[model samples]
Target chain A: MDIPTFDDVLAAQDRIGPHVHRTPVLTNGQLGDLAGASLFFKCENFQKVGAFKARGACNAVFSLTDEEAKRGVATHSSGNHGQAIAYAAGRRGIHSTIVMPKTAAKPKFDGVRGYGGEVVTCPPGTRSREEAVAAVLERTGANFIHPFDDAHVIAGQGTCGLELLQDAGHLDAIVAPVGGGGLISGTCLAASGFSPATKVYAAEPEQADDACRSKRAGHIVEDDAPQTIADGLKASLKPLTFHFVANHVSEVLTVSEKEIVDAMRLVWERMKIVIEPSSAVAVAAVLKNRELFAGQRVGIILTGGNVDLDRLPWAG
Target chain B: MDIPTFDDVLAAQDRIGPHVHRTPVLTNGQLGDLAGASLFFKCENFQKVGAFKARGACNAVFSLTDEEAKRGVATHSSGNHGQAIAYAAGRRGIHSTIVMPKTAAKPKFDGVRGYGGEVVTCPPGTRSREEAVAAVLERTGANFIHPFDDAHVIAGQGTCGLELLQDAGHLDAIVAPVGGGGLISGTCLAASGFSPATKVYAAEPEQADDACRSKRAGHIVEDDAPQTIADGLKASLKPLTFHFVANHVSEVLTVSEKEIVDAMRLVWERMKIVIEPSSAVAVAAVLKNRELFAGQRVGIILTGGNVDLDRLPWAG
Candidate 1:
């Protein structure tokens, strides 16, 4: 697997600079007091398509050659990735196809469609999703963009970390939620070059602790549909993402589902910004392991803000 | 009656500059398209106390003379005003007595206390509330800071509009929700001096339409405890606030409870920001009167972001 370098991150930053928002870095005094850490939150929740996926998707779509661009892009995702791919493709004035599970939420389907992506649904399984994407690529001759496994996508995601280091000045540590490890691995690579002293950490749900287990086992570990409220973090790490996480990440912290929910509510109540469960995972890790971060300046990436308003986790 | 002039607003801006946030102005393309107008939202929801009440409260508290401040300040309120007084007083290192109704939510009581205010609970009624404040003033010789009637408070609230005009550049009209008319009155004064051509309008709940009727009758109209989901807007206008509304406000638009809730949800879903129902009143007005605002650049003040997570209006 080809690993993304710091130069690649800088190049991606230059290419996708005009497309994505350089989202604000926010801090809450009350939340800081609770965690016993001076916390700086890089708000990717305010990103276009409402997630950091925009950075990676835009980089991938924009990096395509003229011949590749004619066929457009295809991605298998039912969440923010699908929306980001569609939005990025739309910005490029290209046709895109999104393969989603039939069991995905209606808003997710709507979000992809709203961004101008043609959606194809399959049965709820890895095999089905892969088959659907293969069929779309075969029929349409579209270039398939893996959600988190592509080198261009990883480089694009690293820009988020590069920005955090630039905006936040100095951080003792940086924590990002690990899903398929795109964001976290990118963060690891960004920190490696931008701020060598800054330790990179990954936060994950205990229910879906494949990344955490893999770190200890010294290999890629996959879970068979392990469930968690952090719906964005259910995916296991791919070979490309695993390589970066294994080498550059300092630690992988896991938090209980209850801890994740509590952290999510704390941010909503204190910061007054809507963040999804995946973003809350990094906060949960900080709050749960206060000893490790106490009295230190730390940065956490707020990954996304897309959630069903009708079904808030805390609401009765 | 001492009506606050635009000069007082400018003075308040300088005095409260260090205490209050120079809140950001945001826009949404999708919402603008839906409204048929370009919308600029002054995000006072992200204010120091999570409400624009901080602007007025800070101005009032900081304007107090050293001798006068020694006796501390007192106010009769159970909502944002109560919390604002507490927060402002805390910032000034002075004692603040907030007289709240016993029927008020526990969180409101906690909010005031948490901000270092002395909470004095009275039996729920205007008579009891007045008596409670009177007793506190008589016992402690604290200066009574009338929530909306005071000149300093009105001038302080005016800073919000001044900031909106300064940040948003050119607005055809500015809309704010009318509660006791403090915010709307402030907007009127700000526009009169800074953006004279910009019309100032008020949005009010149909249930609490006393402001609308009062504007028509050319006199103050009191509601006998009007009920609405917008708890912050239940209070009727006082003479000081009524003067500004009658002389400067262009119109008072009223919206139904459903419209308010729908607008509130639309903002939450699209903007990914938490806003109170009172703030939603302004957005509802812009949506309800699309013809008046179509193709025009309109400014809407999002008043606050203080809401109970468990008791969302749309939640079961």
Candidate 2:
């Protein structure tokens, strides 16, 4: 697998620029007071498909050759990536197929179908999901776009950090939640090219700390069905994401499930924005380790806002 | 009571400009598609104290004479107005007293106390609340700032519409939820000054349709503790607000309780922002009266984002 470079990110920025929102960087003085840091929130919650996944999916879908594009794209995701692929493919006027577990939320399926994607449901399990995607590719001759492992996807996600640097200059550090590591990996490469002195950090859930373990062991680490409230961060780091983490990331901070929920509630109550638990992980890390960021300028990426409103983590 | 004019609005704009946020006007294509009209949402939900009440309260607090300022400010309320008064008074480093019913939520008291305001508890009747405020005023010599009936507050709330017109130019119509009619009344004056061609419409809950009845009857219509999910819209319109509604407002649109909840959920789900039920009343009005606003550009003021997260109307 090829590792994505800053130049690839620049190219991806141009490719996906028109498709994604240059989301605002919001700051709250009250929240700042609590964290004891000047925090700039890169609000990808307001991005296309309500997540940063749109950038990667758009770049991947549009990067295909005309011959390859004619066959369309396929992906297996039960979350934002599925909707992103469908949305991006719709933008290019091409068909996209999303493979998901049959147990995926009704809204997730609706989200994919809303963007004109064909949904293929598989039985629960990673093997079943992969087999379903393989079957779709075999039957439709569509190109497979891995959610995070692909170079194009990482490069595409890098555009978020590039835009963040452009919008909020001279950040002492940048923190992004590490799930499959696509966003944080891209952020690390962006920081390297755009602002070399800006430290890049990843916030991971302590309940599912494979990425943190992988960093310490200097290799890929897998979690066997690790459970956490941050459903998006369940996936462990893959080889491509692990490469960027090993080379560029400064630290992998782990936060408790309670901390994540508390951070999520604070953002909602104070900043008046809906953010998923994955996004709160980064905030939780910053707040939990106030000494590390005290009086410093930090940028925290709010990766997405696609939450089930009826089932918020803080609510009964 | 003196009727506030466009000049007062302009003056209030300058007075409160330094204190309140010139909040962003957000648009979601999906929401526009649903409404069958291009919608520009003036997001006062992001304003200080999480409501446009900050605008009115700040203006009232700052408009006082030096002698009046020394006496400080006082208001009787159990919601956003209480917090707004506290916040505005704190900005000037002056004392503020917020009188509330003993049954008011604990968070409401905390919000006032958070801003260093004294919270005076009164029994649950209007007479008791008024008497409590009277006692506070007699003891502290604090200037009374009526939530909506005051000219400075009306002028202050008008600034929201002025900013809306400046941001979203040439709106065919503007909709605001009518509580005591401060927001919509001010919006009417703003439309008259900034964009005379733009009609102003008020959205009222069906349960608390006093404002709607008042508009039709050409006089004030009071509801005796009318109940709705939109807790912010329970107050009846006063003489000053009635003056603006009778002379300037084009129509008063009422929506069902279920419609407001649906609109609130839709905004949270699609626009990825937190909005209280009062804000949703305006969106619900535009959605329910589709033919009235179809193919037109409409501006809707999202009045606030203060809600009990644990007890969402849609949740069981």
Candidate 3:
């Protein structure tokens, strides 16, 4: 399998530049003081679909050939990626079909539909959702857009890291939350290509530490029904992402669910920006091991801000 | 009594330039679709103390004479102003004393104290808080910094408008939440100075509609114990702010408590930023009177993001 090169990321940036927001880099004196580091937050929460997923999705949809895009795009995601694909497809004036679990939150489905995507719901389970997506793809002949596994997606996510390096200059390290490892893999490539001195770290929830386990075991390790408040980070890394993680990533740090919630609250209070639990995992990793980031310039990727306001984790 | 000239705002900007953030002007497509107009949100919530009050407080602290600052600065505020004063004073390496109502939320007082300000508690009323502030002034020889009525504070707040016009050029109208009217007064001065064609409007919560009533009465009409979810906008407009409002304000629009909450939630969900209820009043005003602002380039001042996270208004 051919891996995406740094040039692909550059191409992705060129493709998605007009579509995605060049999200701002935010800092807080109080948050920095607490973490004992000069922290720069790359706020992808302020992205087009309130997540970094939009970059990859936009790149993929826009890069599609006229004949390929005529049939539309399909993806299976109950979160940001689903909405991202829908949004990107809508921007390209193409149809999008998002396969989601029937048990998924209504708001999640609504988000995809709100972007003008058609939602096809299956029974709750990864297998069921995948099968549903496969059936839809076979029937509609829609191009399958893997949420994090495709080269185009990885290249698109790399644009985020590219922007981070450009805006923040040289950083001691860059941390990103990992689920299927799309963001971290792209970050690794970006750092390797631009700021080779900057180490790339993946932050994962302890309950969903498949990425950590896979890194240690030297292979993809799937988590069996992993449950965490960070609903976005439950998926295990795929072979494409695992290859990048194994080759380039420095380490995968696991944070507890409690720590994720606390870090989310801290960002909301200090930075005064709404971020979902998934984004907080990166910050939690820095806070959990302060010595690693102490006195260093750390760039944390705030992946998304797509939380259900009525069901805040802290309120629970 | 001498009114604050536009040059004072320019001077304040220069003095406070290094201290405060040139907050970003944000726009959301969904929010614009809902309001039936193009909206430019000057996000003061991202300012140094998480509010536009930081500008005024910084100006006030930095502008003080050596002798006046040596004795420290004092103010009576149960919200953002107290915290702003403390933050600004701390930055200047001067002492700050904030007098607050005894019944004020612990978070508000804690915010002031967290910035190293000395806090004095009074009974829960304007008279008691003023007397407490007076007592502090007498004992510490501290220069009392009025939250909104003072010329320096108004000049400081006017910097927000200057920045707004600079960033979101040529707004047809500008809407800001009115409390003690310092922000709106400053906004008026800045708009008049730069973009004179831009009409300035004040948004007031119906629960604390003193500014609207005062405007109609053509005098200062105080609200005795006004109650609203917009805690920062409960104070009545003072003489200095009243003068600016009477002279320059286009109109004062009042929004109900429900509308305020809905608007706040709408911004939180769509914009994905943490903004206080007071800021929502301005957005609500635009939504309530869509005909007045429709098809216009409206600038909405998002005043602050300082809120007790645990005690969110929507949670109630």
DockQ of candidate 1 relative to the true structure: 0.79
lDDT of 3 by residue, B4-109 (tens): 9899999999999998999999988888888899999999999988899999999989999988899999998888999999999999999999988888888887
For residue A242, model 1's alpha carbon misses the true position, in angstroms, by: 0.8
Residue by residue across A93-127, what tens digits does model 3's lDDT show? 99999998888899888899989999999998878
Q: What lDDT score is found at residue A73 in candidate 1?
A: 96
DockQ of model 2, rounded to 2 decimals: 0.87
What candidate 3 gets wrong by more than 4 Å, as runs, is: none
Identify the superior model by DockQ, candidate 1 or candidate 2. Answer: 2
Q: What is the DockQ of each candidate?
A: 0.79, 0.87, 0.86
List lDDT for all candidates, in order.
0.94, 0.94, 0.92
Error of 3 at B269 (Å): 0.9
Worst 10 residues of 1 chain B by lDDT: B240-249
Candidate 2 lDDT tens digits, A215-261: 99999889989999998899989989998888889889999999999
Clashes of 1: 0
CAPRI class assigned to model 3: high
Candidate 1 C-alpha RMSD relative to the actual structure: 1.0
Instruction: Tell me the spans in candidate 2 whose CA falls farther than 4 Å from its real position.
Output: none
Question: How many residue-pair clashes does candidate 3 contain?
Answer: 0
Q: Estimate the TM-score of every prediction.
A: 0.99, 0.99, 0.98
